[model samples]
Target chain A: MASKRSNFNRRKSFDAVRAVVNDVRVLVARGLTKSYGDVQALRGADLDVAPGQITALLGRNGAGKTTMISIIAGLLQPDSGSVELGGIDVFSNLDAAAKLTGIAPQETGVYGVLTVRENLEFFANLAGVGRTERASAAAEVADQLGLTELLDRRAGKLSGGEQRRLHTGCALVHRPQLLMLDEPTVGADVATRAQLIESVRSMANEGAAVIYTTHYLNEVEALDADNVIIDAGQVLARGTREELVEEHRLSGLEFTLDAPLDAAEVERLGATNTEGNTYRTTDDRPIGALIADLGSQSEGLLGIESLRPDLETVFLAVTGDRLDEGAS
Target chain B: MDAIRAIVGVQLRIIRRDPWFLVIMFGMPLVIMPLFVDTIGLSLQAEGYGDASGAEQVVPGQVVMFGFMLAGSVGFSVYREHGWNTWDRLRASAAPAPSLLAGFAIPWILIHLLYQVTLLVTGALLVGLRLKGSIIAEFLVLLSYSCCLIAFVLLLTAVFRTINQVNAIVNLGAMVFGGLGGAFVPVDGLPKIAQYLSPFTPSFWAMEGHRAVFLEDGGIADVLPSVGVLLGATVVLAGLAVTRFRVDETKEFFG
Candidate 1:
C-alpha cells in the first residue's frame, strides 16, 4: 500500500510539474485535498486531461471521484489545490472557468417540472449560451443523446433512462471545452449506457477534454479510455487498459472454503486470504495443484475460480482489493 | 445581471407550470376573512369608528397573516432544488450568491405581490372592502410587504440547512406573528403585551401600512413611514441572507 502510494505521488508530482511547464492539458487539477468533518474525501490528487482525450476515473463508491470532479467543476472548494481549465484558474475566476467546463454530477439532476427541451435550454442559458443559439444548441444536444423525440415531454414524466439522457444532455448543451461526467451511467440501462459512451467519445473527438468517472470496468474498457485508478482518496495508477494490464498482470487460482483455513493450512497451500473464507494463491498455480495441496481440507471447498490478467486484475493488484466487491 | 435574469426566467416558468400551491394559498385567506369580519367590525365600531365595516380589519389582516405563511414557499423553492438534485448544477454555473438569491427572490416577490393584490381585490368584492386611501399607496404597501417578507424568508432559508427546519420556523412565525400583529383582530382589541410584541413582526408593519390606506384614507405621504420601515427591513434581511447563504451548502429537502 505504501509503495503504491509512493509511486503515485512520484508520478503525480511529475504530472503536476509537466502541467505547469506546458499548457497542453485543457484541464489540470493538482494536489486537491478536501475533508468533510472527519472524513477526508480527497488527498493531494492530481489529474490532467488534454484535448480530445477521455480519461476514465476508475474507483469504487466513496473513492473521491465525485469530490475530485466537483472540485474541477467548481461546484466545490478544496482545502488546498488549483484547477485550471483552458488557461483560467477555476477557483480564482469561477465564471470564466465555468464557461469552459461542463459537469454532470453522479446523481441524475434535471428540472423535472420543465420539459426536456426547457431543461436543456435553461442549462444552456445559465451557461451563457446566446439567446439566438440556445434552441439550436438544445436541439443538437438532444439529437446527440437521442432525446429529440422526448424533447417536449416533462422530465418527470420521462422514463428513467430518458431522464438520464436529458440529465447528460443539459451538461453538453453549451458545448464546453472540458466535460466532466461523474458516474453518468450508474443507474442507466444497457442501451442508455451505450448511447452515453458513444456520446462521450463523440465529444472527445470534437476536441472536448473529458473526465469520466465510473466503477464499471467494462465501461472503461468499452471507451478504451486512459484509466486513472483511484482508491482510498488517492490516485494509484494512470494508464491505458492494455498498459495497466501489462504492468500488473496476474494469473492464479482463487478458492473459497466453507470455513477459513488455519494459518498452518493456509501456509501449506502458499495462499493469501483475500477476504472472508476466500484464499488466493499468490503465484500462478493450477486448480489441480491447489486441490492436491488442500488434500483433506478439500472437502470444505465451496468455490474455485481462475484469475485472468485484465483491468479488474490490474485494479486488484494496484489497490490490494477487488473493485467489483467494493462496487457491489 | 444576465445570470439573475436567466434564473428568474426559469423560476417563473417552473412556477407557471405548477401554480397549484399558490392557488390553494390564495383561496385560504379569502375563506378566513369572511368568517370573523362582522365581529371585528363591531370591535372597531366600539373602539370608535362609527362607520366601520369589518372589511378594513379582516381583509388586510388575512392578507398579512396568509402572506407570512406564503412567504415560506420561496424558502421551499431553494431547498426543492436539493430535492431535485439540481442544486449542484446551479452551483456549477458559478453564479454569485446574490445573483442566485435575487433570481429566486425576484419571481416570488412579483408572485407574492400578485397574491396580495388578488386577495385584496377579491376580499373587497366579497365583503365590500372599500379602498378609502390612494390606490398607489395601497400598491406601495403591498410591494414593500412583498419585498420584506420574501427577504426575511430567504434569510431563514440561508440560516437553515433543511426544508423541515425552515418549514417549522415559517409555520410558527406565521401563527405567532399573525396572532400578535392583529391578523385575527384589531390591535386595540388585543392584550397590551401582545400589542407591544406586534411591532417586532413584519406582519405588524405590513398590517399598519394596509390599515393606513384601507382605514385612514392615507395617501402615499401618509403611508411612507410604514413603507419605509418595510423597505428598510427588506434591505437588512436581504443583506443578512446574502451574507449567510452558501451556494455550496448542502440543503436536504426530503429527509
Candidate 2:
C-alpha cells in the first residue's frame, strides 16, 4: 500500500533507495501496517537491511519494534504491506523467504527435553539443512555460540545464560543469509551477552544481514549498527550513531548554581530552572559567552556540563522518551 | 516434509529422554490386569463365555482405558512446546499448519500402537492372554484404535486453548467411554441404554474386536466392523484436527 511517487523525498527516500540498491540488500519492508483491532502495532514501518551490516531497532516498549521484527521473521502478518527477502516477495512466497532468514526472538525458547546438540540440529534440519551436514553444522553452531562444552547436556539443565545462548544458536545453525535477533541479550549475564555479541559479529563478518533489536544502548555501540529510532509505531529517524547524535542530539547546557536563582534571573540567563539550583538552557550561545553575559551571576555557577551526544540522548531527543524503559 | 520429520524426531527424542510416563503406562495396565481378571472373568461368563479367566477381556480393557489416557500426552506435547517457548520457533519454520501438528501426532501414534502391542504381549506372559483369532485382525484393530484416539485427542488439543481444558475432556473421555463401553464390566451385562451407548465409544469397538479375536476365534471378517468403525472415526477426527489446528494458536501449557 506504499505510494511510489517520490525518489528524493527526505523522510522516506532511504527506504526506497535501499529497496532497489542491490541483491546484497537482503530484506525490505514497505508500508507495513498491522493492527490488533483498533490498536495499531505497526503503523507503516519501513526498513531495509544489507549484508555484513547490522541495524539496531531502538524504541520504547510497545513501540512496534517487536512487531516489525515479528513481521520480517514471519511470525506475524501485516494488514497491508510488502516484504521482500532476497528479492523474493516474502508474504507471497513465505517458504522461500523463510529459507533466507533466521530469527532468535526476544524470548529464549529451547527444547528443554532435548540435548543441546539435538536442539541445534533439529532447528537446522527444519530449516532444510542437509542430513549429511546437520551434525557438523550443529557442532559448529554450538562452538560458535559457546555451547560446545554443553552439547550433550539437556538444555533444561543448563544455566539461564547457557540456555539463552542455545536459544540463539538454534537460529544461526543454518547460517541464514538474513538474521534477525530480537533483543537476544535480554536477561543474559555479562559473559553470555559478550559471547553472543561476538558470535553475531562474526556471522555478520561472513556477510549475513543482521537486524538486532535491543534496549541496551551500549550494545548498539558495540555492533556499530545504524540506529533506527521508532516511537508510536512509526520510524522517527534512521542514521548512524554519530549521525543520529548530530541530527537529533539536543544540544544544550545543564548547570548547577551555588544557590537558587530567581525566575527573573533564570529568564535573563535564557534558561529554565529544572530542579534545586539546577538550570538548563538550549540557547546556541557558547557557555563562556553565556557566562560572560551572565556577568556577576556567573560566580554562582557550581557546575557546567555540555549534554554530550549519545544514543540515549538521541533516542530521548527524537522520541521524547527513554529507550531503556520497558525496552529490555 | 523435512520440517515434519525433524519435529517428529525431536518429539521422539524428548519422550525417549524422559520415558517415565511410558514406563508407568506400560506397568500400570499390567498391575491392574490381574486384579480385574477374576472379576471381569465372572462378568464375561455372564455374557456367555465359558471357562474364560477374563485376562483376554481385562488385558484389552486396561489397554483401551490406559491407551485413552496415554493419547492425551499428544495434546500435552503440543502444550509443552508452548511451555518451553518453542511454539513460535516452530511457527517460524514456515511449515504448513497440518504438517506441524502431524510432527507431534505421528510419533505419538506409533508410540501409542507400541503401548497397546506391548500390553497384549505382556498379558500373554503374565495372565495367559492367548490369541485364538487371526493375528492379523487383532493387529489391525490395535493399529486403527491407536490412530483413531490419537487423531481425536489432537483435535481436542487444537480446539481447546489450555491444557486443563484438554486434560478434563480426555480424562473424562477415558472413564466415561470406558465404563459405557464395558471396559470396567461387560457390555452385554450392562443395562439396555448403556449397551446401546457402548457402540458409540472407541473402547466398545476395540473391546468388540478384541473379544472377537480372543473368545469367538474370529478372523479379519469378524473384526472388520470394529476396524471399519475405528478407521472411520480416525478419518473424521484427523480432518477436524487439520481444520481446527492453527500453528499460531497460543496453547497454555501448565494452566
Candidate 3:
C-alpha cells in the first residue's frame, strides 16, 4: 500500500509536468483520494484530459477508475483534493461544473418503462434545453446514435447494445464540454462497440474532452488516445500508447513452426516451448529476420504469428499481469 | 420556470403511463365512497338515528380521502426513482433543486385536484349530495391541503431509501391520519387525545375547510386559519426536505 502511494505520487508529478505545458484542460484532478471505511478506492491519483482529446483510463477491476470518474462528475466527494473542469472547481461550484460535464455511468440508469424518446427528452430537459427544442434535440441525438428506429420502443425492451447506445445518446444530447464514460462499451457486440467509439470520437471532435474507462484493452487500442494505466488504486503509467510501450519495454516477436522441430534448432532460436508444435519468443529485434531464417530452413511452417507492442503489452509489463484478468 | 415545467412534464408523463396510479387516482374513490354510504345506512337504520342523508356525509369524506391519496402518491413515485436510481440523474442535472422539487409535487397536486373533482361530480350524480359552495372556492381549499400533503410526502421520500418502506409508512399514515382527521369519520367521534392531535394533521384543517365550503357558511376569508396552518406545514416540511437532501455521488444510492 505504501508502494502504491509512492507510485501515485510519481504519477501526480507526471501530471504536474503536463499541466504546465497544457493550458486548456477540460478536466483536471490533483491529489484526489477517496476511501470507503478501510477500503481505499483512490489514492493520491491525478489526471488531466485536454480539450478535444480522448483519454483512455485503463485498469483492472477495482482499480478506482469508476471512483475517479464519479468524483470528477461531482457524484462523489473525494476525502481530500481538488478537481477543476473548464477552470471552475467542480466540488465547490456544482452548478457551473454541471454545465461543463456529462457522465455515462457503468450501470445503465435508463428508465426501463419509458420509451427511448421519453428517456432522451427527460435528460435533454434536465440540461435546461427548452421544451420547444427538446423534441428536435431528442430526435437528432437518437438519429445520431442510430436509435431512430427504437425511439418509441421501451428502453427495457431494447437489446444490450441498443440500451448502451441510448445511454450514450442521453449523455451526448446536452453537448457538455467534458464527457466521462465509465465502461460505456461493456457487453457490446463488435458492431455496437465500433458505433459507440465512433460517437465518442465525434464528441471529442466537437471540442468536448472525453475520458473513457474500460477493462477492454481493445477499446484502449481502438480509442487510440492518451493512456493512463491504473493499478491498485494508483496510476502506474501515463503516456501515449507508443510512449508507454517504449517505457515499459513491451516490444516482442513470436514465430510458429508447422511441424515438430528438433530440440537443437528450438534452443538456438531462444524459444520457450509452449506446447505441442507451438513455441513463444520475445525479442527486441525486428521479427522479419526471424521469419526469414525460419522460412529458409522449414518448408512445413504452417503459420507464424508476430505481435507489435501496444497498450495491452505496456499494461502487462507495468503491472506484471494481463489487463483483462478479473474484468467482467 | 423552464426547469419546473420540464420536471412537471416528466412527472405527468409517468403518471399517465402507470395504470396502477390511474386506478388509485380515479377508480378507488369512485368504488369506495358508495360502499361507505351504504355501510353508514345499515348503522343509521339499526340505531334509529335522525333522517339525514348518509351519502351527503360520505361523499365529502371520500373527496378528502381522494385528496390524501393523491398527495401521498408522490412518495411512492419519487421512491421509485430511488429504487431504480434515477433520482441522482435528476439531481446531477443542471436543473435547480427547487425546480426538481416543484416538478415532483405538481403532478400529485394536479392529479389530486382531478380526483377531487371526480368525487364531487360522481357524488352529486349518484348519491344526490350537492356541492354547497362555489366550485372555485372548494377547489382552492382542496388545493391548499394537497400542497401540504405533497410537501410532507416529499420530505418522507428524501429520508427513506426504499419505495416499499415508504409505501407502508405513507399508506399507514394516510389511514391513521385520515380516520382521526375526519376523512373516513367525524372528528367528534374520536377520543379526546385524537381530537387534539387532529389539528396537527393537515387532513384536519383540510376536512374542516372542506366542510365549511360544503355547508356554504363561509368564504375564503373565513377559512384563512385552516389555510394558514396547511401553508405553514408545507413551508416547514419543504425546508426540512431541502436541508436533508444531498446529491453525494459517493453515497450508496448514487454509487
DockQ of each: 0.81, 0.69, 0.39
Clashes of 3: 1
Top TM-score prediction, candidate number? 1
Pick out the ten consecutive residues of candidate 3 chain A with the lowest summed lDDT.
A249-258
- lDDT tens per residue, model 1, A113-213: 99999999999999999999999999999999998898899999998988988989989999988999988887789999999999999999998888998
Q: Please give, as one word, the docking class of candidate 3.
A: acceptable
Report residue A66 deviation for candidate 2 (angstroms).
Answer: 1.3
Q: What CAPRI-style quality would you assign to candidate 2?
A: medium
Ranking by TM-score: 1, 2, 3
* Candidate 1 chain A weakest lDDT stretch, 10 residues: A14-23
Clashing pairs in 3: A75-B249
| Residue A296 alpha-carbon offset, candidate 1, angstroms | 2.2
**B1-255 in candidate 2: lDDT tens per residue?**
888898999899889988998998899888888888888888778777887889878988898999999999999999998988899888888898888888999999999999999999999999999999999999999999999999999999889999999999999999999999878877877899998899999999999999899989989999999999999999999999999887777889885
Off by over 4 Å in 2: A1-23, A253-280, A284-306, A325-327
What value does the lDDT take at residue A31 in candidate 3? 91
> Which candidate gets the maximum DockQ versus the true structure?
1
